[model samples]
Target: MKLPYLPQDYSKKEHIIILSILLLFAFTAFLLTIISTTGSTSDYVPLTNIYLGTADITHINVTKVVPQIGPILAILGTALTAPNRTLDNIFDSLKTISETPALVPLMYLLSNAQNVSQSLISLTQLAPLAISGNPATDTKDLVEISGLLKVSSNESQTLNGLKNLVVPMLQSTNTSNKEDRTTELTLDLLADSKDPLTVAKSLTVLNNLTMEEKMKMIPIFTLFGVTKNITSLIGSLETIVSKGDAISPARSELMLTTLQTMLASNPNVTMAFGTISSLASGDDEKAAIGAIQTMLEDSNNVNTTLSSLSTLIKSNVTQAESSKTSLVALSSIIQNVNDQSKAVTTIAQLASNTDTATTTAQLSALTEMLKATEKGTETINILSQLQTSLNPNSTTFKYIPSLFTLLDASADPPVSFSSLVTLTAWAQQNPQTFIPIMGILSDALAVKMVSEDQLTEMTPTLLEYLRIPVYFQLSIFTLCKRNLEKDILECSASHAVQNLDFRQIIYDALSASEFAPYLNALNIGPNDLYLEGDLLNREHEYVPSIKAVLAMNILGIVFAFVVMINIGFLFWMKWSSKSYAWVIVIFLSSCTALFLGLSCTVLTVVLQVIKSGTYKDAFGVVFTTGVAYSAMMWCSFSLMVISSVVLLWVGITERHLRIPYLMKKNPATIEDLENSSTEADNAIQETKHEATPGQIIRHSTDNSSDFLKNDPDEKQDAVPDIQQTNTSDSS
Candidate 1:
């Protein structure tokens, strides 16, 4: 009955304790399952509720089936814990097991579950400051807003003074003229200004215009117009302000006179002479003429000369005798300059062709002369004298109108001068006087200075700028984008400027700022959320939204599968009988499974608690969730504790204090048993020969009792053992 080498503690007591614990765990888990199934219709416990074609089999429940899962697993795991195989070997086998058809699918399930949980957390956290509660709605609004800004930015610059003013002027409503509405809105924005009340006074002059006055307003507001005497002029003074120019009293007076003179002289001007005449007094007209004369006489009047040439070019020369006469005189002067080297040709090419290359070269020459001359006034005087020379009758004029009949043959400007090479050569050789004069003339046109009329026209255009909503919304989008790009508080900076309140940009324009007057005039207010701020605030919902609930469910299933895999692996190891450290592996593995399963299940219930907010419902959910968690935890814990105790019993009971069946040789074979029987027989014979019959009987009974104690199944063979024990030798 005795084995050659058995683990000391391998016994019925040890097996009984382990099996008892597994039975208790299985029973408790089954009880919980029943309670959960019957308690509430809404409650859906994961492992217990797995439905497969309505078999309704209780044994199929993985959690309750301890004999197949936990005990078998522990046994296999215990056998696997030999001194040869290690935990690392177990882990390697686990990785290999992951390739199994059943387990591989669980990996993806677990991964997806984790993603759902994390994504729900992010959404709830970001929902607070988002433009709308619905993410799709907010995203649509953002796209629309982006489109609006794109169009506004492109179109905002194209609106000139005249175009900006004309639309509002023609827009008449039942309540007020659209122009007046625009002005009123602008006025309200300026209502809280710390400065003097100039806004109302300025708008009053515009609002007082009659129908005829409004008609007159049209022609005088063009930006650049070609004329008879004045070649090019800005139609309005308002452009000066819009372009951010400084306008002193002297500059203002000079602008006003210059505008009047230019308008009166421009034969191609659309405005009537009488209207142009009416805009300036007789004295103002004379002063303007004097200012033009003085500016010309000072030798810095290339501006005036170019203006005259542009006007002559634009004139109705084909129809008007006066324009033809001026052109004739201009041609004669150009011919006179040609006598002074090929410089005149460069000048002619610059003026007629308006070639950028020729113009740039000429301008560069003038810039050099100005730099060399150092005294800007002296350079201006020199250029002004050159300009005067263009006027054939001036005392400062160098070229006089000649009596050459051949010159009049080409009344119109020349079409072509020289080739690209020759023109460049001409510009290079004639760098001194001719090039500088041409340069000065070209420089004069580049700045595009506005006239007083243009300056006055900008008032209405600016008012329109204030009324447009995209103007501010675009600014907010830009600010937020910047803040996002930089990851900083760029939006918090104040941007107010120049009686305009140009700064302090935000997401929703109507709701923010001191520009409430404009909002009121347009009938938008704090209640109107037309402009939405699409920022995500820090606050999140206590419970993740409905989306989160779905995520939790997915994760729970994943956790359940994970726990099952570990239990399955444990059973495989136990069945293999290769492991000596099964007790520790079972204990640790069960704890890990318990932790994963219980944590995820409890988290699902926690999410529900966050949603309902009612303590009554919360308590019920919490209780159910707790019970489920406890059952799983207890199942794993009991498996681990009982499995470890059984292994320890084996360790304590074994004589060799090592695993049973580890040694290669077996000492309990037939040949070894026969030899042991012969030795027993000889020892018995010696005892019979030396001892009395009573001692022999006593000794034989003692030997039989010892043998029976060792082998419980051999109790029936005890009488035969005494009868065959050499009684004749003892007698």
Candidate 2:
């Protein structure tokens, strides 16, 4: 239906009131937009600056004055907008004030600035302005104003100020009017502010009110959309509870009670189960957990809580991943309850679900709960129950096999590790039950290796496969040493032999030739092996000698030493210069051949050892080709070959000696020698002419300065002196 319109034959006073209400509404809408968009009232300063044509303004304290104006305008608008002079229409108009979104920020502004006292006084004085001379309409307006005063009476100052204004107003009203006033105040408080502290304080006040008053407020809570957005209500309660020591125990209890009442009153509020679970499990807040526990213990609420949790755990994978922490917390809480059979059954169903998405979180939460629970008959009983729940079709079955299936299917390392840890702990408690699971473990390992090509990519998988046997063997040995009365070695060895057979599983799995490349990628050595002959009861046949390995290492060290000594000797004798490039080339080439031979021998020994089944079946023996040693040998060989080629090039060019037909030229004749001598003379003359004073000075400083002699034209003197000496010898 369309809203009632203003009468056309209106008085000037009525017209003024209508215009004022419209203007107030437009202004309130604009302010709400600004606060909602920017999330702060400080944004108002920009508009203020724009209107005033000033930019220097830093802050405008609208907190005190604006809140007072909103309620006054609301009362005035409601009182004037009533179609008839009746209490019902005026009350109806007043209810619309609670629906106004702008009142939330306005109420929050007053609450934050601690200006509730002043705002209440202003609203109280303006309450009379809403009187339209009708006794009933005036009485309803006074009751509303009284409710506002009561809701705002949270602080001592505000409460004291409310007494003078509220007592006289309430005395004039009857019981129903008092209830109506309480309802008005409750709605005004609950519906107007979304601030956690304000909501929490409102709940506190509601809790202190009489039972009738609280019951009256419940429907208002639902009608005003408070229960529809129950997550926010729960969130506000969590904010109060999270304050820890800052909040009193009484206040916390009131908050929890308020929550319980909301949950009980509205079944629709249960849709916030995810949020409730998160709050219960997200923090170790006693109040939150207590409230949840109370709900679970109640016969009426238990099913709802359990069903919500189960649905969350069984939700799609994305929800499951995000709910991991919540599930873990729920599991922990369930443990403390008297009968957790249903909860345990729910978690087991999640764990057994074929959907891999939810299994990761389910298994993690279940395993962590199992680990945290103390081991005893209680633990055994829980496991037994879980086994039946997990494998409902089988009569005489163990959960270990189901766990293996889940473990194999899961690619997450944490899930896999947790499963293994649970198994290990269970084995420690019940060794007999663990005995049958050993074969299951072996089968699982084999399946894992076959299905997963990059097992090494998972550190847990690699460690479980390669290192678990050694760790287990050592653990057994330690246990034997501690418990056995005599013959510790014999006792340990006897028991260890039985356990060491599991190593055969690993050996058999890795024996496939296709695994060689993967194994070689890992630095597996003799230490990682369990030699065949070293078994306690086996006959010694092949000892797997390392003499070849030793010989190769010795030869490599000797060659390296020889090369170093030869190079040092050449340098000391001054024979490694350009004239002796051939000598260096020979030395480097010989070293290269020796390194290459050593590298080949090492590789041959390693490959032969691997092929001989010694590397695979060797028990309690360390055998490796020494990956670092082999790499070093190859690198040394490469360096020597490179050096040889470089030195050969230097020797060929520096000495200017050509081999065979590559250099076919005659020796220098006398005329050719003379021409070279004349060219040298001309070069010297050019150098003398072009020399700077500094160049001459540097040349003169040298001890050998024959080229810079005082006589520039004294050329061919050495040649003439040589000719005279030859003539004298002939005479």
**What does the lDDT come to for candidate 1?**
0.30
What's the C-alpha lDDT at position 283 in model 1?
57
Residue-by-residue lDDT tens digits, candidate 2, 101-158: 3223223322222222333333233222222234343233223323332333222222
Which model scores highest in lDDT?
A: 2
TM-score of each: 0.21, 0.21
Q: Give the distance in Å from residue 519's predicted Cα in candidate 2 to where it truly belongs.
A: 29
TM-score of 1: 0.21
**Residue runs of model 2 more than 4 Å from their true location after superposition:** 1-549, 565-574, 577-581, 611-627, 656-682, 693-731
List model 1 lDDT by residue over 538-560, tens digit each.
Answer: 01332233234224333433433
